[model samples]
Target chain A: MNDQRPRILLADDEKAITSNLAPFLERGGFSVTVAADGQAALDGIAALHPDLVILDVLMPRLDGREVLRRLRRAGNWIPVILLTQVGEAAERALALEEGADDYLNKPFDPSELVARIRSVLRRVTPGQPPLASAWQLACPPEAPGQPALALDRRSRRVSLDGRTLDLTPKAVALLEYMLTHPGELLSRERLLDAVWGWDYPAGTRTVDTRMAELRRALGDDPARPRFIETLPGEGYRFVARVVAA
Target chain B: MKITWRDLLLAALPAALAGVAATVLRLSLGRLAVLLLRADIGTALVLLGSSLSLFLLVYLGARRAGIARSRAAIERHDRESGEARRRFIHRLDHELKNPLTALRAALANLQLALSESDRAQRVGDVRLQAERIGRLVADLRKLSELEERPIEQLPVDLPGLLEEVVEAARSNPAYAGRELRLVVSQVPWKLPPAVGDRDLLALAFYNLVENALKFTKAHDPVEVRASEDGRALIVEVADRGPGIPAEDQPRIFEELYRGANARGFEGSGLGLSLVRMIVARHAGSVSVRSRPGQGTVFTVRLPFDARDRAPVPAAG
Candidate 1:
């Protein structure tokens, strides 16, 4: 309570996230206090007056939004960052509009969290400032070398390993459909209806041609394929890992 | 809608006219009988025949009018719901697009990230969004598959399946990964085995319980109960979290339907729809009853064969 380190109140009901994150934040040069739920978080904020608060959006009894509402309603200009679990845009916008200085998604890198906290603190207090959990829990953020394949839907471009590959409209459509619906056994009918219009004058073979062209562009081998797999007599499956950009 | 006295009088005027006409006819018939047959019995017979025919005509006409009114109501309801269905299509795209847009930005940031940690951080961002997209795609598939194919039928122990569903939900990594305990109401019973794909039924129950967990605190009782109701098996999952608003209750089971409160929470919006579809596939029904602040309860009724009435599999 008397030390120089900025105090941070990290409130989340999830023990796994809080357990690993609290230690990481403390090690990163902040005195971390934890609250199990939103109501407890409100109590902690009033009693402790921590430098900053990192709130989780979903909690028992009172949710993160409700806590933020009460805090802002009471004219407390405390800096807050929301750890939103859903990767939704309207929700992110709503979170910020509700007076959060900044927001981060869950299953995030701890270093990123540290960076966000630093930026939000500097902006809030001019020089010195506040607080936040996260990272090292929830199974270590999938595997490395992720997102090898990325698709830009706006430009209708498909990129592999950071390079945009030249693919026809049909190939793009087919790949886009496959990328979006991963691990699905897509029949020729499903592919045709999705990529091409239902009334398009083409048969299932049209789907096969698009598949081959897309495969050729992706440089995926038909045998032991890394990206897409052909399930004989059934349908085609997008077997590769796709991180949608 | 506010029925004035005038409207009521107007409604009664037709019946009143009919009564007056009958009375007049009966009197006239009586005079005719006195003039011709010279008997009061003749007057009574004519009145009885005429009144019986009038009553039959009124009954037939009223039934036809009632049916026409109901049919119009049903058609209006269908049109309104069709409009609602179209309204929901716009919601699904945002779910996938948001994650993908974030992923793209992160990948773009990776190029500019100077330090090794920053690059790692950006990649981590990309990975998380990709996984989020992965979950949405998988959920969509899960929903579509239920409609596109037939379900397998097999004898599934009711109590055992429910216990396993609660168990799996308790350990679900989505509940902040670990050490999160769900308080499920006691689920011990003797009942006939339900005949359906065991895995799907398990998924249905697990989704229900997980939804309950999402809205409620860790210590809140996610009440689970199972009982036999004549020819069906009834299972209920209830929660004491903020109950769904009345307006959102009807659309909650639709695909990609995120309620006002649900949007702030983490969910794909397909969980309940999947449960509904799974129940439908087995000729069962899933329904929700909730009051704001009081909580929500989902009841699933699966019809079982009458022959398997033996109370077996008392295992928990």
Candidate 2:
């Protein structure tokens, strides 16, 4: 039998970060190409024609944003995931607007990146409906007088009642997943597996942190939530109406 | 000795009154005077003596009023400076006590027989605490020097200096996952040079960026943007986080004033104060605009050419 694995180009100036992250990506079953700077990253992406790119926001020469800008200007639609430092929400949004597929803040658990990579790949692959279309199908249409949460996949933004909510990518992802499967009981393990991926450390509070942040952004009280409801020993449920616009 | 018309009038009024009284006495006791001494010499002598006494009284009264006014002024000055000194000492104690307490606790934790990971983490905490203490001391020293020492101003590249500050912030491990962006709105090639101490200006920019990052989340980007504002260059560090409360905004630049929302954050509360001090030392001014739950923008306006401006006077 024949095996074809997805290719990923990892561009970062820090050797310590790339060296560690490259091996992790390879172990997760992707052909990884390393670029030490922005120029090299652009060269590597063109030369390798990788399926996806993980670019660091702060890089020498061209920088991650510039690289992404150039790639999009060249009309390359390959999915790109930005590796950003913390406190860069605006940069993340800008990158997404510049055609980046996703972004993960630095000091991130490598497993989360892997999950994002697979998820983005699945959306871009030939056979499957894109993630956005799938999300739309799962979401209800906007109705008057009812509180609605809408996630714009293209911009990577979440809005409630026409107001853009300030939510971290993780929180946004969690809310998106819950919105897609409204009223379904999602256990902690299942949510973790779906959101953080399988390699994430067990007993880590990744889900809880994301959930708490999501709840806070929604203004949903834990005890009496209008959107997310905690089921005691079970995971959580999105009780509010989710609309796709 | 150079008496004015008013002084002359004051001096003459007493003598004139004494003269009038003496004349009256002379007229009334003319018979008695004629009978006793056969002259008005006694009345003239009494009048002269009374004039001297009244003049002396007026002079003494004026001197006493002047002394009282000077004493009140001195007391006010003393009270104001004393209050300021007390506030400064209180802030210093609070800032120092924080790091000292954290360092002590970290050290005590290190002494425990813990696992390798726990030990390493404890050691990291101790190092961080120590660094915090070092930073506090360094900031205090810099602030004092800024107040006392005259800075060595030189032609410094404003954009390059901002880039350096952003680079330093990027390399900070504590903000490893934090995003810092330097947006130079001016023409890169034609950017004007600012006259300042490179190190001090860089420190001011760094402190502003650091302060923004401290209040914001890892996902929020702390934007450091610089543009030319007429003859002055304006650098703004903006953050989209929980903004400063209206009441806190006024005192945010005050030394050791932590905002109401700053609880649980690891800060010495000297960052903004130091930023203001550094900027002022460069003959610049720093101001902040923030709305609660919206965000904050700290703007530092520096003259493009501060070479001709006088050095900021030392704070008393």
**Winning candidate number (TM-score):** 1
lDDT of 1 at A241: 46
lDDT of each: 0.70, 0.71
Per-model TM against the reference:
0.44, 0.40
lDDT per residue (tens digit) for residues B77-159 in model 2:
79877876887788789877877898889889889937999899988998777767765664565466457655655677788
Give per-residue CA lDDT, model 1, range B182-250, as digits (tens): 342344546778887665677788778778888876656667888774557888888878899989998
The ten-residue window of minimal lDDT in model 2 chain B covers: B306-315
Tens digits of per-residue lDDT for model 1 on A1-245? 57999889999999998999999999998999999999999999999998889999889999998998898878776888888532222332354346666556554568767766765665464221221111000111135754366666545666766677987655665775566445557778556544442211124554765687787887778996877899998789877643423
Model 2 residue runs over 4 Å out of place are A1-245, B1-77, B102-128, B171-181, B185-191, B306-316
Off by over 4 Å in 1: A1-245, B1-74, B173-189, B291-294, B310-316
For model 1 the local lDDT of residue B92 reads: 74
